[model samples]
Target chain A: MKPEELKYAKSHEWIKLGDEAVVGVSDYAQHEMGDVVFVELPKVGQKAEKEKQCAVVESVKSAFDILSPVSGTITAVNEAVAADPALLNQSPLDEGWLFKIKPENPADAETLLTWEQYQVFIKQA
Target chain B: MAEHELRRTVLNETERKAGGKMVDFHGWELPMEFTGIVKEHEAVRKSAGIFDVSHMGQVFVTGPDAFNLLQHLNANDLKKATPGKGVYSHLINEKGGLVDDIIAFCLSMDRYLVVVNAATADKDFAWIKKHSEHMSVTVENKSDEYSILAVQGPNVPLMMETFAPEALPLPRFGIVEKDIHGRHCFISRTGYTGEDGFEITCPNDIAVQLWNEMLELGKPYNIIPCGLGARDTLRLEAGYLLYGQDVDDDHSTYEANYGWVVCLDKGDFIGRNILAEQKANGVKRKLTGIVLSERGIPRQGCRIFHEGKEVGTFNSATYSPTLKKGIGMGYVTPPLKPGTLVEVEIRGRRVKGEVVRTPFHKGGAFSKVLYTGKDK
Candidate 1:
């Protein structure tokens, strides 16, 4: 689901802004990765840098890095998705959310792409 | 430096129209996936899947001395393969390093067909010609004249019954010439996948037509078109050795876990002395399968460690869809038993795993069948 309220990263990760921003890979990214078999999640309270690899997702044929969309400290992680990696392919934007980050700079969301802009950006890619 | 242009097969446009994700593979433009790797992989295991294997090379050898030439060139005993039969063999260098692994088909007493790897086609042809200087055999490369389509899985028999009647009654490793929808094709009951399947070779003009017919006949059986992505994982899970990765010029046949295919008792051939000596003593390292005990994916070039000491590296590795765990093949020091514990360095962390018997996911038709030299 392409929610207008959420921001997108060029690397295909999505961020939902709030008290604690929810971060995940977009549906398009999951589609491109094929069936995800394993997800290595970052531990809670770990600091992450923007545009840097903070997690890993492994498919049957490939392994891809899930870069953090914004610099933050990970406040929470979705253990459910880690247990069943297929959830990422089935609902990448919803129940398949990866983790929640407490951003160091709350205004970082404005630096990301809007949902409509992401749709166009993906087309060009 | 000039960029070399990539070649496309006869079914290239058809594959593109069917949603195949194209990629450059060994100088050929081909599909890496159709629907998706896992979906296509599952389709082959559960039902049937077709692959455009036209990028593979085909060479023709014909003369009164064809058998004599092949017997001296191939590592496997060529005398066992009668007409209408095919056997997998490796063409080796004088030092026992692999030149290229191939399938030799004996069409008649004086004619033989050799299918070689796409990347090594030209080199293998030149090597064969150099070896046949004194012999009267004519070696011709006919890779462009034909296209190959592989229909693989458990549902292949039903599809053959509808479209390829001649191939339906053929025994395993048997090759038969057949007319399908007015086009002549060579159908062989052999495939790289560990499932019961068929490989049909036809002229380029009718290649797309044959593919369409096979798809139509296979429709009821839920046939899906697969690409190279699934082909790699399927063969890896089946314990089949890939040429460049698993077996190459550095490793001999015995070290590659294909010692069974080598006929040491047979008369003199290329690398026979090296192979005989290796058999009498032993190889320093052997190719073995590994399955991870923890949740981690082992990748190519990953280091294998035993008690914190590096022993070898993974040559080919993938996440097995059937086993739901990381599975791989690598060259490790010998004397490592099937249950020997080891660690694979995935990414940076050491993941626990164990050396195991190959053909990781069993219960396929090819694994169960007992070949008795007869058609079922």
Candidate 2:
């Protein structure tokens, strides 16, 4: 499902705001990285600065960094995806969400690309 | 960092049509996977798959002194590759480091064909040509003139019989010149995946047609178009050494576990003195296979540890589809014994692994027939 409700980052991370913001790599990112075999999640309460590397995603061919989409503290990490990284490739939007971050400034989420902008950004890439 | 422009194989269009994900491999736009790495890998292990190996280089040495020239350059016994047969050998530098590993086919009394890695093609050609200056042989690089398609799997023989009947009965290490799709091609019963298969080399012009026809005929056998990703995984499961990855210019045959391919009694050859010395004294480091016991996948350059101390580094690693486990090879100091516990550092985390006897999954076609004496 292409979630227009979620804002995306230029680095291919997606974020949806609520009580806490959910973070995950974009669908395009997961498709490009083929068969994710492992995911390194940040610990709960770990501080993450926007645009910084907070997690790792690895595939058979190579490894990729999952950049934090917003300045925040990781509140919860989805262990299911970590246990089976293929979840990222299979469902990058919902069940594959990586971590929930309590944003340092909730308004910072607006700085990310909107669904329309992300679609345009990937087209340009 | 290189300056060369990317080149495409003759099957570039065909691969794209087959749903290949193209990637840059040694300045060549080759498919890394067609369907998916795991799927393509499974196809070859369980059924059949085809690969476009057009990027690999081929050098022909022809003259009455061809055998003598190859004998001087190759570490193995060139005489063993009598006409219609091929021998896998290492081209070593004077310091005993590998220049490149090759399969030299003895086409006749005066001609030989040496297939080399795509990345080292030019370098290998220059090295071979430089050594042939004083000999009676003529070295010719025919990489662009021809294209190679590797049809490998357990069902490869059956598929080959349907596509090209004349190419059959070619035993392991056997080479036969036959017409494929009305084009003269050399079908060799040799493959990197440890499968009983054929590597058909045909002129560039006829390559696309032949590839299409082979896939069409192979439809009933569940043949799929595979790419480099599956190729790497399959070769790793089979314990095949990859040039520039598993073995390089810094390691000799003995250190790389290729001592059997190096014939110390074969008079003289490049690196013979150093290899002889190394064989006598034994190597400081030996290549060994590592299999992960956990979920983490070991990758190339991952630091290897034994009881928290760094022991070595992975040369080439992959998740073996055949074994359903992570398998890799690395050179370690004081070589670890088979079944010795080790850890691979992946993304700063040490994953549990164990050193095991190689060809991790022994069910491959070639391994079954050649190594275990169990015909499939």
Tens-place lDDT digits, model 1, residues B1-376: 8879999999999999999989999899999998888888888899999999999988888999889888898899988779999889999888998999999988898888898889998888898878878898999999998899999988887787756666776667778887766776789988877778889988899999888988888999999999998998899889998999999888899998888789977888999999888889999999989999999999999999988888899999998887878999999985477998999999999999999988887635455462222255
Worst 10 residues of 1 chain A by lDDT: A102-111
Off by over 4 Å in 2: A44-47, A73-75, B1-3, B368-376
DockQ of every model listed? 0.80, 0.61
Over B1-376, each residue of candidate 2 has an lDDT whose tens digit, in order, gives 8667889999999899888999998789999998788888888888889999999999999998999999999999998999999999999999999999999999899989999999999999999999999788899999999999999887778876656565565568889887766777888988888777789989999999988887887888899999999999988898889998888889999999879999989899999999999999999899999999987778889898998888899999987777766788999997889989999987787889999988876545555353212244
Give the clashing residue pairs of candidate 1, or none. Answer: none
Q: Could you list the chain B TM-scores for each candidate?
A: 0.96, 0.95
lDDT of 1: 0.88
Instruction: For candidate 2, write residues A20-124 as lDDT tens digits.
Output: 989999999988888787788999999999999999898878788899989989999999999878899889998999999998877777789999999999999
Best by TM-score: 1
Pick out the ten consecutive residues of candidate 1 chain B with the lowest summed lDDT. B365-374
- After TM-score superposition, the amount by which residue B295's alpha carbon in candidate 2 deviates from its true location, in angstroms, is 2.8
Worst 10 residues of 2 chain B by lDDT: B367-376
